[model samples]
Target: MSDARLANARWPDVKAALESGKPIVAILPCGATEAHGPHLPLGTDVIISESIAAFALPKLEERGIHVLVLPSLAYAPAEYAAGFAGTISISMDAALALVLDIARSLKKQGFAMLALVNSHFDPANVAVLRDASETIVREIGLKVAFPDFTRRKLAEKLTDEFKSGACHAGQFEGSLVLASRPELVDDDARLQLPPNSNSLVAAFAKGAKTFEEAGGPQAYFGTPAGASAEEGVASLDCMSDMIVQAIAAQLEP
Candidate 1:
């Protein structure tokens, strides 16, 4: 295929690639349509996840791997921000089923691998992905690659604000959106959002059910004013490296 993105490629090109017998890896960028504070757009997670996949295209190509970035999955279990406007939270069961079905279709299409690049950190969403990854490999016989940044090893590679757990709509995510879509960011509001140090991770651990219960009444955390496109670019590079490494490991015999 001339383009690495399935969204832009024709069906005939994909059929040709599959018939060539070279290992074809499909990347599914997973995100949530959730609130990201008043300063950022509702599609912040979608933008970040898709950007990571886009960045990974060249790296995967350089390694002689045939890769296609699938259209981004923009809805997930985002109940934590259900109170916010424009946040579409689906059930965990529904999310899991959708991912499983996607994997099954890819397996039947003769694709060698499916790499899921998820940027949304909702606990339920993460659970669905973890389960789907294992199920896809065990049942569908598909090689699955999922770089879950929520885990400590990957989480540490991100920004300090992200590690601090006050990162929902804060500097960490805000920076990513700013890097990819600056026009979507409300600079004036971002500059005025005071830092919210409450830890979403800790709050969730204690049974907090929503953003308000997690001390994020405005549906944001961390220091948004500290965000910058430069930092965002660096973060994207780091995340893309993680995806590349994960796929490389999965491709090993």
Candidate 2:
């Protein structure tokens, strides 16, 4: 793997990368430190976001774009999972401040654009991120590329389960963990859970506040038993492509 991660790169390497005279885009992977059912780890979203950014790096390099992958942001508003143990649900305002502060600092650090690769699907989290992105772009003119998967078009590219509404900690999310950190997955328990066909989007539409009320009794939905490493790889490919495309549109336009 190339040393594209900003956290591990030396100051000289980072300075050189930033001054490469290309369209430099810093990758900020956002995830939530929340419970992901009985089988998956609490850092499932973090692992997935980092993995997607890693997968997208070499491709961006090939396109003559300098990439800087910041360490995954692990705190976000996950009010939907607040009732579950191990879920750290930050307030919406706090999340917005964190994102805005990061962007402000990055803008001053010589990077031209900030691409947020977020895998957490909680509405409150996404809302804060989207709002923050808009605010940053408006205030400092720093470009932000946020791939909104909640949209039907983008979600359709991932999988049937994703489009069917049982995405949280289900096959869609589990497959990502399986591909990136298989050792973290409890294969036995994951393979035993039945399919939970709850519609998280619809639940949110009805003003449901928690996953428990959204029909995710075990803090998960979707068909975990059917998750495959192959599916995870495919989904990551789609997600990375979306991020790359968003960046290209911003830089090229």
Candidate 3:
């Protein structure tokens, strides 16, 4: 795997790679600049995405998958996290537009495939990524893949305990960051917010109105104290392996 990530590499290098007829896979680390409790960095999504991509790239390259990592899409749809101090969210429309445009650009550049390595678990953002990826695949003739990170399969393989509910800056995410970048996690500042008492499961659940109205006064969902860097590393290793395999399967002749 080349140390030359696309965000740092010159245009000519990217052009040459595209022109070389090699199997190219662009890893777009879709993330958000939002509050992840006091314990975690505001750019938790960005760090997680970058770490996952870094871990996955070499394994992917070994299988002849030329990986180019794009810089993290730092702003995403995070209405739920809006009440938090550091949260910076985009409108759903803007988020979708940005992802779609990036996908279209990658298609035009002649990359063989594009994979969205999303870290933020915002429902609206997930829907947009799914819609945009599908649209690009049909309209622009490019292959796009989005893998859910909070699911049972990933959780079971990555950690010993199964997740309890809809994940936010909870155990799953906090643990991931702890493992990958322990220096960024502040264990003492971790908070364990009460669960949503609303009938709805999350902020985007059917009857959601406002973040406060849906998920209580605070933006967070679960306990962040249980997070450990060891758990985070394990989760990343599991997900990276899964992503690498998915990319390989897609590239199979």
Candidate 4:
């Protein structure tokens, strides 16, 4: 099909692509409008997810899979960062319903697989995705894959500081944005900021309700000062691989 995104495509082109009789896959970039500390833009997760989808588009096509990159789903259950000026979180039920409805719509249009390329890391948001997508896997015939970076295999591929529990707008994410959207970063502010290594993961397990309770007063963790463009590109590759592996499994089966 055309290089245009599904959201921008004419219905005729979409139908032609669907009727091509190939393994049709729809890439949904799930992200959120939330706080990413002081140096990064609010669209960090959405930008990262969309960037990964763009990078993986040709790769998936080369592997003989017909692909459509959907517009980023820009809101999720981000209770962890609520009250942060720009953070907009949906209720858990609403988030799940949105994903389910969209997936059902794609399946109706003939997509065989729906891969969720999500980058929003709030435990609450991830939970909604895991629960909703899991139900779809069991109840629907359409294949659904969400490459949760928190999962062991994908987590291992990320940085040391990321594994430490505080990765919000830190090196891991900063490096990614630096690579894909340099204009969105404030280099001076990032380099001067000290690392906040508080483990939000630990805090969540302890029933922490907000960023401050999790020990991140400025809405961040890890070292944004150390982020580099090179690291960002490498991280992008890892995210792209997650999508490929998910689709490969269904093809093999």
Top TM-score model:
1
Write one digit per residue (lDDT tens) for candidate 1, span 74-153: 99999999999999999999999999999899999999999999999999999999999999999999999999999999
Pairwise TM-score winner, candidates 2 and 3: 2
Backbone clashes in model 4, listed as residue pairs: none
Tell me the spans in candidate 2 whose CA falls farther than 4 Å from its real position: none
Better of 1 and 2 by lDDT: 1
For candidate 2, the lDDT comes to: 0.89
Candidate 1's displacement at residue 196, Å, is 0.5
Q: lDDT of model 4 at residue 200?
A: 78
Quick one: ranking by lDDT, best first?
1, 2, 4, 3
User: TM-scores, in order shown?
Assistant: 0.99, 0.97, 0.87, 0.96
What would you estimate as the lDDT of candidate 1? 0.94
Report every candidate's CA lDDT. 0.94, 0.89, 0.74, 0.86
Instruction: List, residue by residue over 22-112, the lDDT tens digit for candidate 4.
Output: 7778889989999999899989999999988887877787787778888888998887788789889899899999888888888788888
- Evaluate residue 126 in candidate 2 and report its C-alpha lDDT on the 0 to 100 scale: 84
**Residue lDDT tens for model 3, 1-253:** 3564887888888889899989788888888988775567889989988888888977876776788988889998887778888889899889878877888888888988888888787777777787887887888788876676655566456543324444566677888787778787766666444433332254455657545666545554555666677878777887888888778777777
* C-alpha lDDT of residue 184 in model 1: 94
Give me the runs in candidate 1 sitting further than 4 Å from their true place.
none
Error of 4 at 200 (Å): 1.5
* Tens digits of per-residue lDDT for model 2, 186-246: 9999999998888888888988899999899899988899999999999999899998888
